[model samples]
Target: MAGETAPLGPARVCRLPPPGGAEERVTELCTALLSGFQRYEQRIRARQYMDGLLRTQGRKSIANIATTLGAPGDEHRLRHFVSRSHWAVETVRQALTAFLEESGPASAWVALPVSIPKGGEHTVGVSRHLSPDRSRVVNGQRALGVWYASERVVAPVSWRLELSDDPPTAGRSTGGGPAQEGVPAPQDCLRELLDDVRRWGTPGPPVLMDGRGEDESGRLAALFAGQVPAAARINGWTPLAGGHRTVHGRQAVAALDALSPTLRTHRRGRDGSPDRRPVATATATVRLAGTGNRSRQENRRLTLLGVWHEARREPGELWLTNMDESAADSLLSSARLLHAVGDGWRTRGAAVGLRDYEGRSLHGWHRHMTLASGAYVMSAISSSSDQARSSGRSP
Candidate 1:
């Protein structure tokens, strides 16, 4: 059936919170979006158009947000804000501080991972080799995000997105057919992400992330390699890498040629049969191939810092973690918290993976990133609630 043509609809009038309330909600939502998840800009903008002009587009677009917010009655200015915005990061930070007022005063252990989406050729932060796909020709800016997981939490503590660039390639170009080189590395973007997290400063549990260059056994490791109880995914050998094991939502499987010599007991099935002992936990770093002079020995000091408490693996995905079954499994068994942070943008507002819906041109495409780390942070809160409710711990 062919779709019918429609005229400009009447201005939407949504059930928006009053002025003070609206601001508060906006701040609250934005803060949760920023500190709690990556893709703050997309989220913040989506919230803004929940009521008015944007609503006319659909429930998923910025226009929908305007309708949700009761149209704000300021079409001209509001439209402009929605079209071009970049204040999401700062706004989210402000909201977090305001929220921490009550949740503060407790030790907080944090874990964050920055995911680099693989696609595109002319992306500002695109690089070669760092991508798992091994696409000599990369696409889009490299995405490095941070996920925060509090000590007492099981789900994500929060999320952050960092668009980073890498050294340029010599034999790769569009029109010229693979013959361009001499750009720069994306070390700056990595530096900025670290600096931002440090400024956020936590007085509680030590901060943690996957083994980053700065995360050595030093005083400034964002994620302390020494303690605070953490279970991370590992690569090649790191001693802590064990046979297929899982920690709550985190799963660690074997990697191609990255498996280590470690034995572990696993549950093959419901029957109490002991699955052949898999390797023990292991962790190590590798200098991923890039288009630069950063040699393997110079930047690659792979080591097993500590044992991870979870096995972070995806289905049919190979993963290695520096964790033993006894240690990593223990944390996984006790886990019961989870949350997520994601951001998506579409020129035509269609679902990201879909073939076509609406874009000015035929080849229009949208980019959406959903980061999942600190999945433990949210699960922890859920566990606590269920336990409290079940045990009649209510006040």
Candidate 2:
């Protein structure tokens, strides 16, 4: 039962300076995001909560944050503001999306799957899920993060929590029903995220994600067909047909294996020396297994890209893309953006308490994530500004 315990109670209050530099810029960002709260007090409380998140160290539980802000008595008020307030999370997300758009042009829209390990089942959407590496099982909340990524800056603007069908049997009541019924599939959740981006009227950038299994690849290929440009890694054994070379049917690995490397490149090693592992890339025109009722030839056509290492006999990586101009370097560049999202989440995201919320309500989770995302954006912007100024360039 040690790892199954909930977070601890509040501690004594302690005074800490606000999150270092860029206070004024972060304040401006908070003002833009919290504008939807009609009450002035609500807006102020939201600002305080963000400040607490930014300033708190270690596990950013509400109690710890409250203590760090030297307002231990306001803990309950902050809790209620996050869990029980009627603030619209979507409005803040839309505003954040607008803010990111105005900041600069995004290179790619990356979908990042975040798995937060939790100790208790009472948290909303907490369930047993496989770790990202699939090495072991973890009890946690699974959330899909939509990130707006560019060459210099990356920030998460929206999030969707994956709710479990089983109800928690701890201190929470479910009225003898599941915690939430008819939970959407992963693809559906992504579609909903895309819908939000579309509704926000932002430019549609190429979508990127790690290789999905066969079933998901098929569904995703159909979803992106004629809808938007996308580049998703697919499993090597995924079936495909109808290449430009009149191939009848073959697995992705086989299709890519038949082609020679069209491009080759090298990268710097960890110690600043050139890495010995040479990378090669190749491409073939192919189509996913299922294409539903679309007559346009271009809609059904997709490029099958294979990335190989000098040491491997077969292609080491396989990807599928529907972009109009699928250059090898362009697709490779898009794939690199996924790393930016990962790095941002691990560093700035953790620092801002992205996974530190201990509440159990759906609304509370959304509110917390929205604010945490704002915190990440502020930190990223601040860091970018610092780097630009140090490099003698305008931010």
Candidate 3:
């Protein structure tokens, strides 16, 4: 299969072991996983998760897993491990970290819809009594838009933003108390995502995300040094000067109010322009309804309402992140990757990857899954590499 041809993404199917030594591919996958070990803790978690999943549940367990990487006959073991609430949380965190490390260095744009279920009464890590699945309350399930970027390589990068928490159980409700704010704080989530990529031990490309990353509009002020940066629909708003509706920034209030309605859901590459189409955006300038003031407000609340016309593909669906404004092509590339990864998820029987199975209470299922999945991705890469090499061509 070394010299044979194969496409990329879903259209491409990798061959089996090549006639050449399989050592090189194994080395590459291992090295890749190791290089990002510290940056992406999921690698470690995945290995462990797999170990537990592949273990003989009853009595064939090893003395101390930490002491043995992969025990003898472990491959034949098969009694899946479960995850606890805390372990599930950490496992999700680790998976996100790994995603950043593996693709952040080479990607200039990435976006994913993150679900931040309001902790009214059913949140696991919070003291709320809310359950989105209850069907009694209106406007349930809040999601913080997410984005990741690194302007370094050309690999197709994607982010699968999924919720790690459990849904509200029957006959339970969480309507009182403060909402359990999303991870890393609303304002810092975006920057924090970038920080995770930074730990990859490699210089990353320019990263861009949605408003969730830069929660308050004021955060956008600290761009790549004065270049009013736009990341597709990261902030979920178009371009406004004095911040958007009720946003606490320095744009315009009228500029902000007019945002929601005027925002375009989608736009084509050649938007009726002679030379590669004019960059048209779903823009508006208005005063937010809630906030009365709209002048040179210092940290005044405004709304960041924007639907990037540039990266809009599916009609009625808004591109809610910075990618819409910044990396149009990269956004497209990521969308495609997401579609391919979707298949893998169904095949593997889970929406989130490199995660452990969650059981009630405080089980350590997540660590086990992360360990297994991390090892799995590595193994898959190696397998593909071997198949390519076997066909007589370098992968």
- Candidate 2 per-residue lDDT, tens place, 130-170, comes to 65534367888877778887765678878877767664422
Worst 10 residues of 2 by lDDT: 1-10
List ranges where model 3 is wrong by over 4 Å.
Answer: 1-24, 27-104, 109-192, 201-317, 320-356, 360-366, 386-395
Overall local distance difference test of candidate 2: 0.65
Global lDDT of each model? Answer: 0.30, 0.65, 0.33
lDDT of 1 by residue, 1-395 (tens): 00011111111211112223333544554456456324555454434432232224332333333445665454444443432332333334434433332344223222333323333333333333343223234433333343333332222222232223333332221221111134322333334444444556454333333332221222122222223333332332222212242121112223312433443323321122345322223322322222133342224322232222233332211122223334433433222111111111112112222111111110111111221121122222334455555677541
lDDT of model 2 at residue 349? 89
Rank order by lDDT, top first? 2, 3, 1
Cα error, residue 65 of model 2, in Å, equals 1.0
TM-score to true structure, per model: 0.39, 0.79, 0.43
Encode model 3's per-residue lDDT on 1-395: one tens digit a residue: 11011111241223223233345544544444444344344444434543443332322123233234445443222222222212233334434445435533344433232332332333223222223223232323332222232322111122222223443231121221112343333334344434444443243444443332323343343222122223332222323333322432223212333444434324444323445633333333332222123343323222233323233321111232222333444444443333333334333313223222222212222233334344444444455565565678776
Candidate 3 Cα deviation (angstroms), residue 64 = 19
The candidate maximizing lDDT is: 2
Error of 3 at 182 (Å): 12
